[model samples]
Target: MPFQAAPPPPAPPQAPPQAAPQGAPFPVPPPQWPGWAAQPPAPSRGAASPYPPPAWRPPRRKSGAGAVIGALMGVLALVFVLIVIVGALVGLSDHDETVSPIAIPTFSPFPSREATTDTRPTRNPTSEPTSRPTTRPTPVLNRTAKNNTLYRAGSLAKPNCRAGNASIYNHTQFKALILKTGTCMGKAWAPALERVGIDWSPPKYMIAARKGRGACGDYPSPGSNVPYYCPSNSTIYASTSAMAREYGPLGSWNGIIVSMMAHEYGHHIQSLSGISDSWWRQTLDSGSRSGKLALSRRHELQATCFGGMFMRSIAASYPIDTTRRNTLLWAYSHLGDPPGGPRDHGNTRSNAAWFRQGYTRPSAYQCNTWAVGSSSVS
Candidate 1:
């Protein structure tokens, strides 16, 4: 009686299983797949199932649309890459087109001397001298005169400047010979200059007996033995005695006289062409003594070239035989600047070479000293 425990209540009574409802579809059993547990017994109607239903699986989606979209995106990416590459190539081409190699500057101040083909109309030498157009074009002055239009003119006409038998020793005969030579020079050069639109007029001639002040300066400044042209007066001044002393044994030769006169006439040509004025301006503006001397050498050498051109033009009529040619070359060799002296004139080699160039080439363009390097003019 001291340790008695109370007893539990009795269990409720169980009801019988119900039958299937009318017109209800029967449930299909799951397939027996490998590695799965066996099917459990079906529960009574209206009763809960013993196991959870299998997990739900959605229907598979079509891959066609996704594949097509991905392919389009890939094509777009490829196009973008190509555009970038093409743009880069085009930019490089543009840069190459704009940039060029740097040109080296020359030391000479004049324009380039590269040979150019002359296409200007040439006058016929056989035509009458007065047949030129009544209207004449004005010559181009300024720095352009250094490389004037005269250079483009055709070869100088031969005036047939025949040398007379008169010896340079006779004053009257020498004067006649010089006058005749000058007349022939005018005939040859006047029409040539006119063709180039330069005014043509004969320079005054004077055979002086003594040194006196003239339009340019005193005649025969110290150590100068040749005839001088005074551009200011457009006259040539030469002394008979000076010529005799300068020429020595060659004084009797008419060829020597003609050459000397021709050289002076060359200066006259320069003056008429405005080259002398342009050259003088450059000389005055030169910064150093050496610079002035260099320009002077070029000027003198150019005159020598002109003299040679005239000589060649008249060679047939003047009958420049072997003896005369040799004498002229020898004279040129001695006409250059003396050693240890002011080098205003070119050296013997340069003077001779330029003269030979003019004789052989016979073109004013060939005598363009300003268009060459200093070494060439030197």
Candidate 2:
């Protein structure tokens, strides 16, 4: 055979390319590397892989010396980082020692008026609510008369009272004077009673032509001619005939009549202030006639003092001159427990002394006859 280059090995047979199946993605060619062999295409879904299985190999063991050296270097780096952090903290602490504290602004939970719209009506600062009163209500009763709150109520306020030349001899004039005096007494006492926590109401008056039955009993009981106060009805019952018989010509003096009325009104005050009730209870519990009489004397003497106190309060307005004052003192001196009588009322001297004390003193404290010695009241 002629020496010709062996014909190139016959080219390997290749399968013909097929058309892509319906709805199948276009095939992607494998990437080529500079010296590596081309890898087969990835298998289609559900097809066997064409690549060989990867071979398993033993894990490489780290060198002990190399691990130790690497660990030491890591520790050194951590130490350096810790040192840097500690130095920064120390520097910050030193700087903070000289720094002043900052004040934080405070905010209220309530909204500011400018930020919120108020729909409510404005309230007047000066106006008080109707539900509350300007003053407290007066009490109905007190504890005792001797050391009573009335003593601390200061002086009695003067009221506009005028005798106006009214003579007690005339029936009409006497009744008018009594009513006017009663009204003035109420006005003068109301504020003082309020101070002592006691409510005050003017007592009703019944000036009868003849003796009649009253709330307590018959008006002119045996041996009693002056007017009497009935706590049960808060009324002053008096018989004009009885008063005329008892006082005689002295009743004509307006000052004398006024003093008598004031003494009776003093009983009304005791009733209203609970002093009469307390005294009655004590009198009943006294058991002995002498003890009861002593208590009675004290009570009656206090009335005289109260009468003087009221007269003093009206001295300026009623214009009680030296003559009227002398008349009052003389009347007080004469009005006392009669000799060989029950001795329920105090002696003439003691009664006059208490009246004088009240007239001279500025407050009810001087009129507390119960606080004095028994001999003084006697």
Candidate 3:
């Protein structure tokens, strides 16, 4: 969660105690494992024999050493069966569940932070997108803004270096120009934002909320589960630290973090365009009698589209015919997809189309998704 509290780390699982020698019995209770339960009657009372379903029969034994080896094989088979049976349990099954997609989101959504299951946004990203450029800025963004400064300043053009807290993080490793808190919206992202024409420098005012607890305007309110951009405050707050602990050490946390930061920054882009404020007012004007508080699915999907823009911008650093296309495709697939909960979120296909819409076209005008009768994002 980008705006919620970090959770306590999980304790390591404890091993079951060793049993004492048989003569000096440990006097343990019968194994509660359901495998030990008497078998249920057949699905129908009229079935064949009184015996339970036939136990797995090990292969037939050969003469001497072969028989001994077969007996050992039989014991191993029993252990395997026990393992398979225990795995049928819900609690046991959950323990071994693997998140299918390789990407790890930097943080979970604010509302779904508590949902620890495989609740990643409904993404279907390509296996390998191109790499973003190294720290030095490159002038690859195609632009229409007559007065664009990105070409002039290069990497130093716009500055919102709030989340770059040098003391806490090693910026060089991430390849970002800034560190935590000194930069708020990922200055490593500056070039990408420039690619999308969202080059308005976020002011110090925006930094106040992303700083530490007392950072009051100097920093963001800490929490990862409830990431939001407070229009009144003009700040974006996220607490992905817990999530970092959850997925970072395992080695796939960056893609998730970048995607999420891109999403929040997407909201910032909306604010800059006056869309968020306009929509907020519109939602308020609709009144309680209105059937929904959903200002529109368009808004959320637009942000998803904007996020796609960032990824695309990053991907653009790679040449057109490179293998990175697949990586970008993979990332594009996930961002636009619905994480599968409420209809509030768009699904994978919608996400992919919108992301692709932003990527190939690369324009804010093309991303105006709220017009009547349009699924083409613009």
Candidate 4:
């Protein structure tokens, strides 16, 4: 009976073997983060794990006071950079822009006295351009010269000028002479302008030992060679000091003096007719020295023609005998361009020839210096 007990333990009923999971076995889900939902379960059994444990990683640490200090320093550095940029801008705003100074021409007087005898024309300066004419077309003033009737020779009728024979001696005498001559010029030219329907006015005459500065800009110091016509005020500025001292015995060369006066009057006429202003614009536009020189030559040559015409008109009244005529011609011809100087005035031959053209032809059309070749003006 005791041996039967051992068989009794084996006799405990055996349960049926457990079946494989139905459908498919699901994988355990990964742990959820504090604020996140649990992830979905992995795929069926026999498949590699769909959700594996996250990779090994070092734990995160909080920033310390040192890190905070470093961040503050970087912010300060950024502020410093902004301050420097603003300072540079403010500094620049405090200064004025630089400007270049304008150049002023100085006095280099021409030899004061006219030579008694006709001397050989002064040789061209070592740097003078050859006399060959430039074939290129020159820029025209007076609306291309064609449209402005004043530029045409004989556009002005003959000016029956009176003889101006003032015995210029002292400063007072010279002043009187110029005023008388200017008055006579006004009388003669006013009517001529009226005939052409061109406006006319009496030009102011200023005779001084020195012309410092005026509407025309600075005058060369006391001894400058040239007399200037200031269009700004319609004034003629002549150096009585120079003329009296150098060409003294002024009474002897009455025709020459009058002719010189007429030359400037020609410029005044151009101004009245709006030709000079155009010429000046063209000269400024020319830009280059040579281009300006060409334009200046044309301007002066035209004035020369005008002077000749005026001289011819007054010839009977003024009595320009052969010797006086030669003197006048020599005065013009001898005024050669200064060697190595600006060819603002034409060469001797061109100067005299243009003058002669105006004198002999007595027509505005004949004196169209603007239409001639550069060599003729040169």
Candidate 5:
């Protein structure tokens, strides 16, 4: 249960001064992941997978994998053949051919049969190579391979990343809310991931974003701000309060909220690309900065860009009518910055400008705030 940290505490809903300024149009929309969104009709783990749908299994199932297994099987067959040959050699070496001049009945063609030792040419035995029994070695267990690329899967195809609507607000309902959100966000990012030549094939990787903390649980240190992505777990989770505070209260945009989920999805892509690990390691030696802020900021800004990339993909995939299109843009602006509040939350100016860049040019390279200097942020 202990990955790094709790339960639903009172999340200060009323951030008195941090509240959106007056006349700021509330970027509201229908709640996340409409309840009936279709799940990817594929099996994630098993029949009762976390994905909730079955995968496309091949009609004529394949029995064997490939090269490695075949190589192993071939070696086994060779060993069997060698063992037989070795046994025959040992038996032959033990038996000696006896030729005795036995005095027996002489078949009369005179006494020709009496003393005949018919020996042609003497054959010399040459030493044949005998395979010595070699001790086959066992491969060491690689703990890293098991956790090389971890991922937490969300409940696919539920509405608003939650199970029920306004009627419910319990722990179970909150978890379902988080699960629905996480999976939907995962679904949202799947396309861009493919476009970018990234592979997200499961068993390839996914975290079941459990109701836990830090590495595997809820974020914003819990009861701080909205639910967010945790880079370590490569996941995004939502609690009921976090959902209510972010979505239910129209102080933000639903599209941007979903975009934030996609932003976290960007971090997942970062993890897969091996970029996050490098950043984390580099930060450890980066004594010049206060802790890991430098790397963290890069990660955060990049995720924002990735969120925009998802939005771009979404727009391209479907027709966003005039009203709906504006809704997303409004949502983006509304959720940009919540004033000079929490360090975890990006500042308004940086948020707006970065979102602008992402909307125009959607790629990780375009959002490299690290290169432009820290001064570029303000």
Candidate 6:
């Protein structure tokens, strides 16, 4: 049995070659290997692979710088928003703290009413031969010694200014008293001005809590004891309430009242003499802060001196004893320019001294405050 040749194992079976589909374009050869034998004809030259290329995946990209930059940008945006909100809150808080109210002082009389208007209707044209009227502007008296009529005014005779009244408390009574005193002042000044070749006219007097639409423009609030002389309207707006409130409590201060009224009257004298106009013109020409202050001091001090002259003229009739004189001097001191404020008016010493000059001498020559140097006025 072992020696038998095993009858040569049957020859391995071989499949015969088969023809490609009858319509094939190219001839086909017999298969070679098992699975890779026919790969659907080597993909015709550049044609895409039949089996999808391993699902495509891009090269891994490093995102380190981009990621960090993006995170930083987000943080900056948030900070900007916070800063805006904080700034707005701080502004509101500061505004709240800065708001408050102002209080008026009781002794703040003489608050200068620093104000006017015309309501004339338009005239209809008339068909008539209008004649040229011959009229001339009134001549202002400024051609006196030192170019000041007051300076040239010689010793003025004592006037009858014996005003009766200690202090009138009632508003109406106070007004009447002022009117009475004004009458006396007019009587004294009219003749004096006439003698100096200056035209004389009494200024309209008024007493009000507040005066508006005055000749000047707008009347300042009244009651701080300030009096105003409106050149445009030739009026004197006196605050009776302010004066009465300040002086009424103190017994009758006839000398003080008279001196105050005289001070205002002095302005009328200046206007008539053209002193005020000249002074104003000089002020405008100077056009400087110190220059303006100098001019204003001279103007105000001159008026104070003129007031003294009036007091002297009336001394015989209304005796201003030492006590009354002292009272008036004190008032003059208080009327001076505030410390560290615009020196429009002279200081306390200058004010009292100027008044005293006129009071003691009773002459316009002695009251030539404008002729003095800047230091004298200051």
Winning candidate number (lDDT): 2
Minimum summed lDDT over a 10-residue window in model 6 is located at: 1-10
TM-score, candidate number 2? 0.65
lDDT of 1 at 115: 12
List the lowest-lDDT window of 10 residues for candidate 3: 1-10
Please, what is the whole-model Cα lDDT of each candidate in the order they appear? 0.70, 0.72, 0.46, 0.63, 0.47, 0.65
Query: What TM-score, to 2 decimals, does candidate 6 have?
Result: 0.58
Clashes per candidate (backbone, < 3 Å): 0, 0, 60, 8, 20, 10
Candidate 2 vs candidate 6, lDDT winner: 2
Q: Candidate 5 on 1-378: residue-level lDDT in tens?
A: 001000001121221123223432211332232233666766656356455557787777545676678889999999999998777656643442221122212222222322334333322212122343556454232112112221221111212232234222355644554455456556655544444445663111222223235555545554455555565545555445555555655433344455665666666766765566766776777886544664566557666765665555455333334665566556555654346544433555565556656655544455554445554443
Selected candidate, larger lDDT, 1 vs 4: 1
lDDT of 2 at 369: 69
Off by over 4 Å in 2: 1-108, 112-115, 118-142
RMSD of each candidate relative to the true structure = 37.1, 34.5, 30.8, 39.1, 38.6, 42.7
What does candidate 2's lDDT look like per residue over 211-261, in tens digits? 789888888776788888889999988876777677766745677777778
Assess every candidate by TM-score. Answer: 0.61, 0.65, 0.40, 0.56, 0.45, 0.58
Residues 1-378 of candidate 4: C-alpha lDDT, one tens digit per residue: 000001001122232223224431211342232344667887778877668979999987757987899899999999999998767555543431221111101111222123212244433222233553567444343434324545432433334455555655566767777777666666656766655456668898777765457677655334354567888899888776666554554347767777777788878877776767777888888869989889888888778877777777766666666777677777777655777766888888888887777666655556666666677878
lDDT tens digits by residue: candidate 1, 243-338? 767775765567767777887898898888878888899989999999999989878888888888888888899988777777787777777888
| Alpha carbon lDDT at 358, candidate 6 | 72
* Best candidate according to TM-score: 2
* Candidate 6 lDDT over residue span 1-378, tens digit each: 001111101222233224355543212763342233455555568887668778778977769998799899999999998897667656543433211111111112222222001123322222122354656666465643235765555756566766676345566767777777677777777776777677778989867653444666444443245676777677877766666655664446666766777788788877777778888888888968999898888788778877887777776777767777777777776768877878988888888888877777666667665566667888
Model 6 pairs in collision: 109-224, 109-225, 110-224, 110-225, 110-226, 115-216, 115-217, 115-218, 116-217, 166-252
